[model samples]
Target chain A: MRQRISAVVIGASWGGLDAYSRVLGKLPANLPVPVLVVQHQHPSGGDKLPWILDTRTAMHVVAPMEKEPIEAGCVYVAPPGYHMLVDVDHTVCYSLAAPVNYSRPSIDELFFSAGHVYGPGLLGVILTGANDDGAAGITYIKQRGGITMAQSPVTAEARTMPEAAIATGCIDQIHDLDDIGTVISELVFGLGA
Target chain B: MKMPESVTDEQVSIEDIEIRLLLEAIYQLYGYDFRCYSKASLRRRVLHRLGMSGMPSIMAMTERVLRDQQFFVTLLNDLTVNVTEMFRDPEFYRAFREEVIPVLKTFPFIKIWHAGCATGEEIYSMAIMLEEEGLYDRAMLYATDIDKNVLAAAKKGIYSYAAVKQYSENYRRAGGKTSLADYYTAKYDGVIMDQRLKRNIVFADHDLATDQVFGEMNVIVCRNVLIYFDRDLQQRVFRLFRDSLDMGGYLCLGTKESLRFSACEEHFEPVVADMRIFRKRQLMKRETR
Candidate 1:
């Protein structure tokens, strides 16, 4: 039986821009669920990721305002120097707390919050990166009965992130970078047989 | 594949309930309201305190928190977000100098409130900017925080020398006219901010959660502080800011925060939208017949 997915969370670090363009760029403009992305970046980094991703993806990408409502089809990217968490009330909240895994917008923080809130209605995706930030998050998502996916190690620009996530034995699918969008679309829209 | 019945589901719900009760206990015993704080972050902080205390659970921690004043104070420190740095978002400072300063020049005197001024890094940063702009003598800066401990630190105006290097870089990027080193004298392993900067500054305890407005100001900078609050509390604070600002006063929030959904959204217009600088709208003139 297929469970209804409410939100899709994608986490990446090193080489995330290219990976994001490949995966998120393919997601349809009329997606039924919100996509939250946490890409590790410098603390002083400006809010340019959303604008860059907005140019690539069909979905509307934005650096969400504090306590902004989670809207369908919109892609919310975590701002630098802050941890983005999903509140139980379906709003995005930013945290100035200590960085986890040396990352302010840690994937683990977002995943833990979203998994706890969305439970089985979340789809957690781990993409190309050089760290193990998203591994624990994927484990939590899986434990919460959410679907988890990872980019195949060979296809990833930096395989450590996906490899680490794959090592957790929690991921439901391992797809090539190019095929991730299609799989996500299928999982979200139930487009496949 | 069929999923197993999750035991953690029950555990999660139970933890959440315990947390709610714990917050309620804190509020009832002491007036520091953590009830309206964003729960995800609040829970993380509470659990962190619980872990450090080596308590069994939040319930057990709450028992100690209610009985012990010192323990509760430690918990309050954990609950309040105190992470701040000098010129943290340099672009915001740059924008303030460009857009807000020109208008501020028109006023004979300026009153600026630094709400939640943790450790006073940004307050001193502002003082330096004002000093460079030749507005320091005419400016009265109020630095306030809920935690007295950080406020005391803010008053001391001494920061580690290691952090000062990054602060210098941030100062430069923030369009500093002179070297950041000029503002502080080096002490033993630390730098003490210029005493003159503190002359016009007043450090005090002000809780946005329950405190009333004290003064109308030319600018109110409460950055990154509102993110911890829930919707209702945020709205209340927004109204407080709106009422606290004189007509045409500038309001600067954190880079990522917005006034879009607030009740006072229409009360101010964006001066630098990217930097989150806003100006309170002037009152409508009565028609002259």
Candidate 2:
């Protein structure tokens, strides 16, 4: 049987961060699912990931820990220069690999792995980015019977990414950044059902 | 600065002086401190702003920017580069575990700043560390970036499932305690990170290029985000980060980034030397930046 959504995965670049913050900030503390973020970033150097998100919203955001068991109601970010994936048993995993699309934390890497692990239980969101990193991943989500959404062109900083996903005609909703929270909430709690 | 002669019919007009005067007018009318930015980059960014605003000349744009705060804000958006992410460097996280965590155990309530945290991945990564180390409950992480759009993404904490897999092995090498899967449940095709990790974080739009100091912090990490700047811009940022550190506070830089050539290099000693982590010297009093 298809389980209700237990996790949400988001991919973005360019103008993505601001949009993500607003949506995550609106989510209440007791959200039913966990969230994972994979943003395209440089692979070497810098500070901790959790600290950045902690200040942006009330959500308890943290970077993925190698070998850490995935749990609901928390947020996991992919570390830089590594791919963020889910193990068969639902634990977070990271790896260093050659850049896909010249990006270490390729959105495709995260989406495909999660698609394999979560099957029909996943929900994917592609936000504003400069390139088409998440296009193939969105297709994977759709094929697996998972819900998919993209940022509307009106709100995207660089509409190329969301537009690319939309071109496949596989996306369920193309939402404005401001309205994304509603989509997530509805999916997470089966709200309005 | 030498005055440039705009001689027409033997009448000498100082065109260069007018440009300097324009900059001063911008400063006086608006609070933007572009006076110290590299002349070339500032010129380019200002020119771009001018084009976007459909001004016929820099003089006209300057006049408008001086009058409207919103215009200045738009100019500010173009001036700063707000590009970054969480645990931006996989090796840096690995090194932090190997080198820094052993020492961080001494602190009670750790205060950290992700300076130039364009999109806030660094903030999220640090919070995860504190949690794994049992320090999160008492920790406060501050993430700042100049770009409003990126800051919003850092706040959302949602990602696609396919792309996150790229970092799977990196997580395995970083000493992740459980399957990465346990932290989030998959949906549609993406993963929404858990909210609890963000509890102690505060993401704000801050500019190291022009903004004043925020507060003393135990660690300040500004990564690959700074390479886009010129030497002078780098120096200015280094000074700001230096001023914001508590005694012996840690400073982490991008892998390709270093403090060796920075004006404030002497202010800090290497912690994880190879990882570009530094410890601020205890004796260095906070300078009046």
Using TM-score as the measure, which candidate wins?
Answer: 1
Tens digit per residue, CA lDDT, model 2, B1-289: 2222222312112323444666787667754455554333344345446656888877776677678878766666666644444455567888887787777788777788888776565677677767877888877889887667678878887767875565455566667666556655578998777788788889897867678888988888877655445567778788788888888888898654666556777788998876789998855366523
Tens-digit lDDT track of model 2 for A75-186: 8887776666665457655444345667767787778667756756789999999899989878877777678899898899889999998887778888889889877887
Each model's TM-score for chain A is 0.97, 0.93
Deviation (Å) of B269 in candidate 1: 1.3
Q: Runs in model 2 with CA error above 4 Å? A: A1-193, B1-79, B185-189, B229-233, B283-289
**Per-candidate DockQ vs. reference:** 0.54, 0.01
Q: Residue B214: error of model 1 in Å?
A: 1.4
Worst 10 residues of 1 chain A by lDDT: A184-193
**Candidate 1 segments whose C-alpha is farther than 4 A from its true place:** A191-193, B1-10, B51-54, B283-289
Give the distance in Å from residue B196's predicted Cα in candidate 2 to where it truly belongs: 0.6
